[model samples]
Target: MNAKTRRLVAASLVAVTATAVLAGCGSADRGGSGAQGGVLKLWTHNAGNAAEYDVVEKVVNDFNASQTTYKVEIEAFPQGAYNDAVVASSSSKKLPCILDVDGPNVPNWAWGGYLAPLELKGGEVPLDDQLPSTVGKYRDEVYAFGFYDVALTMFARKSVLDEHGIRVPTPDRPWTRAEFSAALADLKAGGKFEYPLEMGTGGSGEWWPYAYSPQLQSFGGDLVDRSSYKTAEGALNGPTARDWAKWFRSLVTDGYMAQKSGSSPNDDFLNGKSAIEWDGSWDAAKNVEKLGDDLLILPPVDFGQGPKIGGASWQWAMSSNCAQPEGARAFLEFTRKTAYFLEFAKATGTIPATDAAAAKIPGYEPGGRYEPLVRAARDFAVVRPVTPAYPYIASVFEKTAKDIVAGADPDAALDEAVKQIDANLKLNDFYAD
Candidate 1:
């Protein structure tokens, strides 16, 4: 966290009286020696494991070593602080040359004039192959470039499932809500697992939305009505959404998922305390590394209607205040065009954003534990809302899902979510009705 960011967040904390904590959000301005030759400063919020950092460092180092025209210096920061830091740095005229912004922040930053349009004359970032949903539009103009691909998938311990006599769902097959309920009940009856499901609670703001997003889709509900950009008047709280909330709530009320635990949901599954872990494709890599070939990945659960698969594309963007914008664009283009993205995919244990990278990287093998995850990622991937106010909108759904799981009344929860979202939409100047 930098001084400017701390000051801004402190002021916002006092004013809003809301949990908009973006503390420790900015990188400690690091740069390469001899800016006389034009150095490109890069700041990234993706703080993967230590090994992942090493891979990124190596890539940056390789880039610096390969070229002498301009040195690229990379700085890291926590994801929580990224947007705040970027916003603060831009205000202070200390923004980095290359900025890696997330999906929701991309549009907001671009629209706010804090980021330079990648299509500018000197902007040479190739976004032709990127996902249209992630970085395609920004106030009717495109500014960011999507790089990495992340999709949701179901993860479970194969040993626990087999011990409980639970048949694993097929790679291409999705289980209806009834079949899914029975599996959890069977696991509970056999006493093989204390909880059949465990959703991570690292931060309710981020994890909770994902837990219910897939179900929302199956129920024929969406977070934001693409056409209207409002949930209260939209289908987000429709029958499909109601069913999802009720069913998910039952998992906690009926003692299927951890309700009051502070530890990670994945930790519970790894300890054999839970039968399944619904996580993103990123988890496939961690589980494979943690449990080796013993883990089983399954397609997301179907609501009898069908499962809703969601995914997002990661992007790398150059800031408007960057001194060496051309150099930063070169680096961005390199990461996307070269084998760097493929290396990133393999190292980070995620699917590549580009079709070319997907073809080059090692894929899940047949009969493997992750085959189902790979299949699910491919067949049913849905990206989140790409609107400028997406994070705020996602919060509406997250809070509602959390309340429902905690045994709150379904109708009351939906009604409250609708009310709160309407208030926020109005405050944020977005349309709610």
Candidate 2:
């Protein structure tokens, strides 16, 4: 079989497995008893993340203590294996009533009938108060919500920028494309670091789309046409997209960034190996600890369409097969309290979803050290494409981006990627409305 055929076959196998899994799980009446009576199983992707797991455990314990009607039992899975475990359990009709889903996958799982629409009454955490990207919606209905979300930013040291005469950018006055490139050149000229910028290219999987796609969008191109969600024909391979590809490749070719950066880009930044690091808000606390007052969380540069950053983090949702959705919803609602949001943000070093929650957190409050992150999320965040075909889109983009950065012809690689993406969307009937 040809390469396309192999990819098709692999995609087909995954679809068939997903279908079987959904069918098996859907056939049962798994939603447990009502809100007042029985155990509600909750699964989370925090098995190895001790700090996050502790917060989840505390929430479950608090919920059980607060209610006589339901007891929530918890199961944790490692982030890498969580999705597969959920799929396998779903195939066997053994999925938990409540589970945590990565924000981007919420649309896919909900479309596949793996999740139920969330039911929230008026004045429950004020959905309006939460960051726009934290609420996972599909087809105009919310399927999940998260207490915290992460923001992407360019990390640098104020002292380095000041010493080098590089202007520090902020949310209101972000660096223009020319200025950003000039800064990189200036940093490189100093000969103080191995690379002027660490793009975190060593990270794999979702990190590719999450980290780099925003740069494409900022250049006035997108993964797919949002108006129809039908194809990536013009969007993925358009002129602006080509510019993004070329510029991205130039970073490595010009030696401004490493083609394959070290394992921990943040560590490298702290260790003075790189002048700037493009990373997530989760690294803010550590960067601050090491750099003290010198740490600078600068806004992303504006290539053209203003600055843009990836949004949405892990969120909670009810399983379609859950017999006790109300019970599960109760637990979710309880966990959305401001105190819990503050607790999770403190524990995970993530941005709280709500303003009220942000106020309670030390560095996240208004005018605090990490407050720029909240502004970044509010002003520049862009959630990944909300389509059932997103997984395929992300995978294709990841491979094509890596190829482009490795010196593949920009137009040719993107064109081929567009072709593959179009084919996948068509095969799936455009993931029809």
Candidate 3:
């Protein structure tokens, strides 16, 4: 779809889905489950991803086999359509007993009463060992748990950086802002590659905020002030944020990176068109296969505050209207096995949610290759703001960031964003409980 179409659809979804989740919830019958001692339905967004789907399917099948009193069923949708499907299901009160949602949206969903606090029976899956990003929480209660998470990191060929005299950075000592700029400048001046950096800029939707807002945070600005989660105000439109905007645009205008990277930044980097690529752990396996020992999965640049990256991917939750909350919780707890975490991490090329799961995977073991990504996630990862206003905030940030990257005045764009965000928060009474 074109940019305009995508924006329109996203906005419409935000409105329609928000209404569906808030209005007339708890009015649906059965929520697609048995009234008592009956089958429990589970929905997932992994139908299009066979590996993850298989892992989910196995978990469901195993749960069904393990208990005679309750049998869990699976219905899957493509990731792109899953949210819309849930919204429609919710409007009709056909939501499954359990459903998986994006981690960042858990707060919104829970706040809208679409999800219930995950009460795992028998403590089947202890959450203490899992990464903080894998446990989705709001109002001091966990609403969702995820299998794995992806870390945002920089990638380059060790040989190329070595030849360029660029020092490979570590989690403890990442490239400072000046050093990163100098490295990019050197790569651009070398002229071996036209775009010294490929940042997957052609992507849209959550990618814009999820991939870039952390850079803004590293510059000592956040999507919103976490202290109250009330307004963007000085947070998004502040001086540090403006610096982030100007520096980001400079990456494109100064010719260090593509304004719109090719459809695949990883491919561009692999093909030698880009010296360095900023991407997720999902793409690291491919680069490793191609570059072998020369592949460098380096830490993000420390833009003053510290290196930061977005966290929280997809997570599973129990529907608030589930007819059998106990059964739903049991099913959710069943899926949190260490084996499943390992399977998911291996299949999806993401970091394991728990250290035990990480130990099971090669290169994910401590002090091994790719462990820096795990460290980055554990150290520098920041979950998006926890509030019902987040979806709107994310959309605003996306638009403002895009405009700024396209040469719009950062201050003006950011001020407009803050105005809209404040208006929204006030409209919702600060999403009061």
Candidate 4:
């Protein structure tokens, strides 16, 4: 799509405006004794996930109706502008009582003392049944919570597979890179598709970490060490990294995948231009609507080692400066417990966080058309490193991958990334013995 078209599409997808309340939220200041006695602000950007806003509206309305101590005002913000607004709000102490924070933003907000630590309140739902990797931690503290979990998996048009007599890949037995390359070649030879795969472009490391990392991990590579911030000591610069870089460069160099124009791969797949699109399960709902019921998904390509891990945690955190930490905790508790979140996930195509919720969720099956795509969240989930300096480390990984794909030397890119990461660690006083 052209730049103008892309922007238009993006704007359409993310047009969310949060309604704010100025007065009658109670006269309690943030830290005043009236902590539990004011208007609470809640913000989120998952409008595309589901259309059941009324379900949540009822839940919040119920909470408001049931309480006299505080009133919660819920608002929706455009996903593109959400983070900036959060940052700006942090500066003026205008931070909401509850906010939807991305995994990467967890550490920054936590360490910067912009958010309050969460404390489970009365009537809080048990999250022990949730995926440990999904609702677990941010810098060793549980800040945000997610109801829907997403993973990167392969997507194919059933018509294309049938036309080429190609077997769809499965989770237990996924296609090898060689097999994938052959399938793409066959499809193109028959004039079925212009490119074999639709790769993601630069962003908040969403699609790249999900769709692209699998190829690298198939070859035993990784973007960054989830356990440690150091790239030199871990998996980012090893043989796997080099092999992965070569594989990616081959797509552009060998004329399989098209040149990266910074377009969304999901759109390409939906429009029938690309046969295979590497993206997260988060796009499943829209794809199903656009591409039809014949959509077949494959697990991450198995590179002989094992399936690569791909998925990110969406967390909810309390502001450390929150005037009513107790009230904030209550809000988080309500979000997780009510039927609101489960219904919300069903609409969005996100994997449910809790196993019980996952099981109780209507229409969840073992191995069907949409199963591989949804179950990918369970089979190949990998949490990004939970550290104060992770944003810097994540940047290093993204830049190195991009540079190597653009023809820069793999070893050189890794080395530079390592230097930057190490410097960030030291600069942040995160140096270890």
Q: Cα RMSDs of all predictions?
A: 5.2, 4.6, 5.0, 7.6
Between candidates 1 and 3, the one scoring higher on lDDT is 3
Cα shift from native, residue 325, model 1 (Å): 3.5
Q: Give the best candidate by lDDT.
A: 2
Candidate 1 root-mean-square deviation in Å: 5.2
Clashing pairs in 3: none
Error of 1 at 39 (Å): 2.5
- The residue pairs that clash in candidate 2, if any, are 30-323, 31-322, 31-323, 31-324, 32-323, 32-324
User: lDDT per residue, candidate 1, 14-76, as tens digits?
Assistant: 123313423443333444212336777777776655655676787788878878887777777
Which regions of candidate 3 deviate over 4 angstroms?
1-31
- By TM-score, the better pick of 1 and 2 is 2
TM-score pick, better of 3 and 4: 3
lDDT by residue (tens digit), candidate 2, 1-433: 3333433332332243443233333322243323325888788889899999999999899889997888887777667666765665554446788899999988777776677898876435777789999999999999998889999999999989998899999898999999999999999889897689999999898999999999999999999988888889889999999999999999998989989987878888999998889999989998899889999999999999999999999999998778777777778877777888888888888999999989888888899999999999988999999987788889899999999999999999999998998898787667653
Q: Would you estimate the TM-scores of all the predictions? A: 0.81, 0.92, 0.93, 0.81
lDDT of 1: 0.64
Deviating ranges (above 4 Å) for candidate 4: 1-36, 45-56, 91-94, 121-124, 202-205, 261-264, 289-293, 359-362, 367-369, 431-433
Model 4 accuracy (lDDT, Cα): 0.64
Question: For model 1, where is the 10-residue window of minimal lDDT?
Answer: 10-19
lDDT of each residue in 1-433, candidate 3, tens digit only: 3333323333343545444333333333343654646788788888779988888888888888888888887777767667766765554456788889899888877776677898675544588788999999999898998989999999999889988999999888999999999999999889898989888888898999999999999999989988998889999989999899899999989998777778867888898989889999988888889999989999999999999999999998988778888888777777778888988898888999998889879999998888988898899899999887788899898888888878898889999999999998876667776
